[model samples]
Target: MADLAMPEIALLGTSADPPTLGHQALLEGLLQHFGQVATWASDNPMKRHGAALDQRCELLKTLVESIADPRLQLAQDLSSPFAIATLERAKQRWPDRRLCFVVGSDLARQIPSWKDAQRLLEQCVLVIVSREGWPLEQADLQILRRIGASPRMLPMSVPGTASSQVRRRQTTEQLPKCLLPLVLKHNLYGFNTTNP
Candidate 1:
């Protein structure tokens, strides 16, 4: 089929450290722009907590399963330190197509801190979802412009929910319904089924 030739993908750098509303909002925004969305669950030596590589991968599979669109899929990698590798792999897998890397504004704020950020930006279009209380800085925009990345901002209701906050809430606060299944399945955020 002609559909198979050009596969548009959006790579989400999710720790799945218990995927939260922030991650969901980012993905939903990307889903609107691309025909295909491939979420990347990475194994970063630097990350301290969240779902293990296999658990995060499985969670991504579960999340993708409910999507009705045939274009959406999940990809797993245990070696890629930067999300850019996902972009590179996507390009290699679908050389003739358009691909974009999806990220949250929170991460966008930290782009300069990432490994090989310039090279990453050069390879893919960036679809950055805006988060409340956090916006991209002039320096970030300058870097993005320098790399020729058409950075975009998408709006989503991702207020005070962050993985660390979620984790702390699990200790003393009730687990929100939307995050319950994922927390239980991944045993993340210190969420105990018996209590939370």
Candidate 2:
């Protein structure tokens, strides 16, 4: 058999309110293919009041504790104003590794609108996992190609869950078990959700 090669991959996610089992599943997948998996939480400008930066960072730490792999380290803040610049910094930090940016199909579809989308493509290879009901349009695909993103789809089913849905029903009796700890730690439900 030919030797197995480990791809250098980095996973980025938002523990915006809290991370659910689906997020854990994604990270597990990343650890399988990459030699090193660095995870970063997003400080999305659009999300007005999910969790503060420090709290979100703390929740990420809590969620990562369950993972057994040492390769998964906390990625520095990538939620800066210039996403492409942040990606460039990440490339420099991991000079010995082949950097790959991992995201869900929901976010993948909106790649064209991202800040400096072309520069982001030039800095890192994008690996987008499938999310159910998130239609991948030809226009977006063309845009990704134009930006030099070698997009590859992961063979996995999308978990029909989202932070929005979770926040909407915060008062429900039972919360998602996997994300309960994170939710409680960050006081996720305490935030005002007038805007996502």
Candidate 3:
């Protein structure tokens, strides 16, 4: 008898300058839907400057260690500005497996305006995680359907965590327990080394 096909990989792209508990929660939730998750900090045009890519990767590594889940893999191999570019690269790395691109509802709304938007949609299955405040509209849903896009909306249970808010607070106690030391060690988001 023929063996079953390999499980698809969920490529979750983000600018996790400081990986939060909410982000961790989202990953845990994703495991229920997707086979496995490959998370990485890709370049989002909106937030250009913060803690550098290496720093972000290091923080993610720390969180992964704390979670101790083998399914969650950190993939910072591609730093492209276009979603399609990243999707293609993942294909190259894991040629035989399928790929699922996960994004927030806010990002989903903006995808229609991205570079090679239609091509991006075609590259992989799009999983839009619906968070509080940034809800998807009916028209946005209709556009996705009209464009021949492969998409699914998953409700994410996050604790109102935003990198912007973490930056403003500049307090490790305000962030995830696993992430606190990394932020302090790197002096991220304007954390004062001498003071902290």
Candidate 4:
């Protein structure tokens, strides 16, 4: 069992193909609630990424740096497609701290189908942040609770800008300014120098 007295650390893993204003807002919001927030860019097994894992990591790193908060860190080492594996790695890194796995409302419904999900839920507290379009349903929360996950809803409002929308639009308007140079340099997400 995790030590309840220990400091709570928020662990966020996302497919940050091109970290957007929304991602930055989410991290900033997390900082206001949690003592420490560790985030990383990872490959989602269910989705096809527009950028490579390394590139995505670089993009996320840039965003984390832009936040300029000591408590917020880009933990690329914890990147893993499987939540269980990421949770295990986090346990190894922060042996004494309580880990809270952070997810968006869009992903909250898919937790049960993940590999070793029960074990993952049992190990860490699940924190769900509501997205603009994806609303969390009572049925979903009940399902998560039934499977041993003590899910908590984060009251932060994140911008609706999504990576898929950015990719489809192929514009830099939705991306953070800090990430624009990297996106332009690599030409990721079909964004070019001419794109405003």
lDDT of each: 0.64, 0.66, 0.76, 0.92
Q: What ranges in model 4 sit over 4 Å off?
A: none
- Count of backbone clashes, every candidate in sequence: 0, 0, 0, 0
Off by over 4 Å in 3: 1-6, 193-196
How displaced is residue 128 in candidate 3, in Å? 1.0
Q: Mark the 10 consecutive residues where model 2 has the least summed lDDT.
A: 1-10
TM-score of each: 0.78, 0.81, 0.89, 0.98
| Per-residue lDDT over 48-95 for candidate 3, one digit per residue giving the tens place of the 0 to 100 score | 657888898888877767777888888878557778788878888987
Runs of candidate 2 exceeding 4 Å displacement: 1-7, 77-81, 171-182, 190-196
**On a 0 to 100 scale, what is the lDDT of residue 92 in model 3?**
89
Q: Ranking under TM-score, best-scoring first? A: 4, 3, 2, 1
Measured on C-alpha atoms, candidate 1 has an lDDT of: 0.64
RMSD of candidates 1 onward, in order: 4.2, 5.0, 3.1, 0.9
Alpha carbon deviation, residue 2, candidate 2 (Å)? 23
Best by lDDT: 4
Candidate 4 C-alpha error for residue 93, in Å:
0.4
